[model samples]
Target: MAYQVLARKYRPQRFSDVAGQEHVTRTLLNALAQGRIAHGYIFSGHRGIGKTTIARILAMALNCRTAIGTEQRPTPEPCGVCESCTEIRAGNAVDVIEIDAATNRGIDEIRELRDAARYSPARDRYKIYILDEAHQITDAAFNALLKTLEEPPDHVIFMMATTQPEDFPQTIRSRCQHFSFHAVRFEEILTQLRTIAVEEDVIAEDAALALLAEAGDGSMRDALSIMDQAIASAPLDNGKARLDAEQIRELMGSVPNTVFERLMEAISENQSAPVIEEINRLINAGNSPSQLARQFVRYLRNALMARIAGENSELLQISPDERARAARSAMLFSEEDLTRFLQVMLRTFDELNYRQEQRFHLELGLLKLVHLQRLLPVEELLSQLPAPTAGKGSLGGGPLPGTLPRLQAAPAPARPAAPAQSPARPAAPARTEAPIAEPTRPAFSPFEADRDRKITSEATTPAAASAAPPAPQALTPIETAARAAETRATEATRTTETRATEKMQPAAVVGVAEPIAEGALALAAEADTAPEAAAGGSLDLDRIREAICAALEREGHNTATALLDAGDWKQSNGAIEVTLAIKKTMLALTMNAEADKICRNTLKQLGVGEKLVFLPGEASSAAAAARPRAAASGSVQAAAMENPLVRQAQELFRAEVRTVLDLRDRK
Candidate 1:
């Protein structure tokens, strides 16, 4: 006899020997014990999952003659040594007929079997007909067997098996007892392999058997076949068969888990060089790029499952050590990153076969994975940005010197002292001193005022007028009186000259004096109310702007503060103006409203008036109408021509400036 492979040599001979599919086995055993066996039976499942084997066991149980304690009936558990059982196991039972439906699939063949079904058993208690791949039978053949299948003789049993049960017509399926099978579990497959290894005296490691079982992909037959191949091809050491994971990997053209770990680490670290080198090494070692991609996809899937389902997920078929390693690798990536990596590899696997340069494509895909952005939650990213300063308004303060030039305060006019009265003029109404008003405007220091006066006199006086300013050093009483009289006469002359100049420059003088007067009055009122204001502790325009910004930030109105930070602030006639570009109209409105309220409250607290105003970027319709058309057009053209690129294009094309359009003006 030819040497039998492990699959055939260890074929399940009894119902109890079958692993998994307990549903089918238990139902069949119960039916036999209660003598409730059906006339027709159908077994359906994936290949190598014990469909045909179960059918054979059922047949032997039906025909066995060896009784259990002289009961004159067949038993659920067949006596293997009995002639009927031995013959069925050997596939030579006279009463049992196993037909390959793939070859005998026509109506004529089914008709012949249907005719044979009418007769009684030749020897055994019952005649059994088992058809494999029963779905392959033609429609006409299924129709011919329908009547016989529906009501088979009591002494005959019809057993049909197919991997695809749905292909059979409903009319035929309804008449048979259907038993569905499922793929065997990993543990069952692994246990079976270990038992075979020990029984065969093959020196195989448990890890090697586990790998073989995983490679089987839920098929016991495939597992046994792979084990047989490994045992034969395994190199002998000290006259003993030796098999390990490395040898299995070499035979299967697979990379070890360690290789996958190394690749994952390199990708997480964004090291493209090591990734490229690893790929080259694998390719040089005879590993197919497409195969490696598929294995990597599997590895990532395992790691992802471990992350989501913990280390004890049934989906993860790896060992505890491998699970721990996978869990550690999973910690290096977020779920989004792992998912993206899987997607890229799976897509590359699909395209790998079509590409002419497989290695190039693989390298490109892996490189993309290496440079993929780290996945961070939106909340976390937002937390890293600088937070806005609280409770501050951008307006309310005066202009910042850093942003704009400083304004110089004009000097106040000095008052001359009254002359001492002699008894002769009868005390021309004792000179009354005007009450000093609190200074609203910032006052110029005496040093600054004196410096300005000197500068003014130097710039305005003629050489003759300047030279006559020397006074007599020592004098008698008459001389002192004469000197004072002469000095008064000269001052009167200078005053006459200044008044004439002031009249000539009335516009400049008036414009400068009005604001100074208003500021002075305000400062005096503030000083009278609070002594601190007199001491220069009162808040100024700049301080008000800073305080408003601080207030806005405290209220979580960061948007308003940011907009105001780049704004222009001005104070004219006691009114404060805040000018900002209106990029978003609604946002501008909201910010203005909030800022107005905050500015009012802050100014009230600082003893300032609540006169805040928002300046619109575009002129109103009435204002535009009031402007001269020619001047507006000229301004627009000037702005357009100011851009270098626009000017170059105009010169190149010898074009005149047409209408200038503002994109922001459009709806």
Candidate 2:
């Protein structure tokens, strides 16, 4: 006779022999021992989790003649040597009948079962029904069995086993006692496999067994099945099964971490040929694209774990050799880079299913892995770079001054050492002409100087005024005394002219501009004629805007349009409502307050009592109103030059390129 497969030969025969399901087994054993069994029991869990086997053991326990004869149905453990136990193990038990619910899912079949269930057990203490894949039963059959399940005969017991418990009707499920099982753990599966291997006198390395255990993924049956195949594929001598890790890997077509290490080394070194050659070699060795993708993902995961855990890597469940290889691979790639590679491999796996040629996908994925240094996200790539040569200005100007580049524990780019001292900022632009000379004659009398000093001292402390001296000039005692009466006028004109020049001049010139350089010019332009206005009134919107534009141009136009077109003047209740449009709500509030203060201060100088209301609107509206008046022509008129609605949408969304979605969803 041919040898029995390991799945069947090593199947769990007793409750204790089952792995990862002690809770379900212990409860059933207690019920059987105490004679508190329910009419129906439902066992549910993932595949290969001992659901069917538990159902069989329950059936045998119910019909055990030895226990019944001894009236010691007292012990929950079924004596496997008993006639009922032996028959059930052989799959030909009479009273303990196992039905494949998947095959016998018809209404008529269930009706026949219901009719037969009405009779007493034939030559047994109880009649046990084991329904496998019970969820696959037809709706009609489920309805027919529902009534019987709720009120079955005292001797009849129903055990339904299904991977999907939710598929059954709630009524049917409520009538049954539910038992949930969990997938076997890797360590538990490995321990069990080791025991079986030793018992069978199989010679195998622990590493080889570990690989089998991981592939099992909490499935004892699957692990045993793979082990059996490995044994058969091994070189046999004197009827003894023997195998090594290499042979197991070869048979399973699993490329070890060494392959991953090589690929990573090639990637780090920027060599594509090795990875390409390896891909071809793997293809020749019969590895499919999907399988390769899975292997790549596994390697990537190991690499990431190694990178995070570093030397303290006791947390990982990998072999020592694999851990060492992982450590090496981790040194070559960042966790983020590995994560990106894993993500791409997953996508490659999906693409493989749709690709007419799978090799192409696998090769492409491998090539991507080899060239990962170039494919990493910009942030991640920057993290891998060395502290940016201190203002050598990275290939793309590193993070702005005083700001550190974000890092993520990735390998930084290899670069030369930077100076200990930080690089200096560029010098300001050169002065075009010689400095202007101060007047030799006094501009004020001694009394005027004293009054001016008194006024400055009254507004602020004497120390502050002394620290910031006014323009230099010689003065007579009498002229200085007279200057005291005109101190307010002189100071007011000085402040006004200083502001005008600062606003209208470039930043480079603002620092050195003299008080008298443009004071006369500014005063002429702003001379007030309205009797209600102050004699020195100089407040104007055009002058302020021009000043601001000049001050900002020296820095850059980056925010010129945004600042200018971000405000609008609206007529509201006989007052000018200055509505500022800004993308950021906080910025809008800030600009509105600043504009109100500036307008009020300037208006006070102009002798205006009206309060300025700084409101806020969409920035796009301001942009529309600010556009230059265009000559209406054939295409220009048709194009609707600077429409307020479209400009509003563009500014609000910050998207210059408009699409149909933008037009259709305007608020």
**Number of the top-ranking candidate, with TM-score as the measure:** 2
Encode model 1's per-residue lDDT on 460-497: one tens digit a residue. 56885577765333332233333443343344334434
Error of 1 at 580 (Å): 15
Give me candidate 2's TM-score against the actual structure.
0.58
lDDT (Cα, tens digit) per residue for candidate 2, span 324-369: 8778778766667778777888888889888999998887887776
Q: After superposition, how far is residue 526 of candidate 1 from its true place, in Å?
A: 47
Q: Output the number of the lDDT-best candidate.
A: 1
Question: Model 1's lDDT to the true fold?
Answer: 0.67
Q: Which portions of model 2 miss their true places by more than 4 Å?
A: 68-74, 268-271, 302-320, 323-335, 369-667
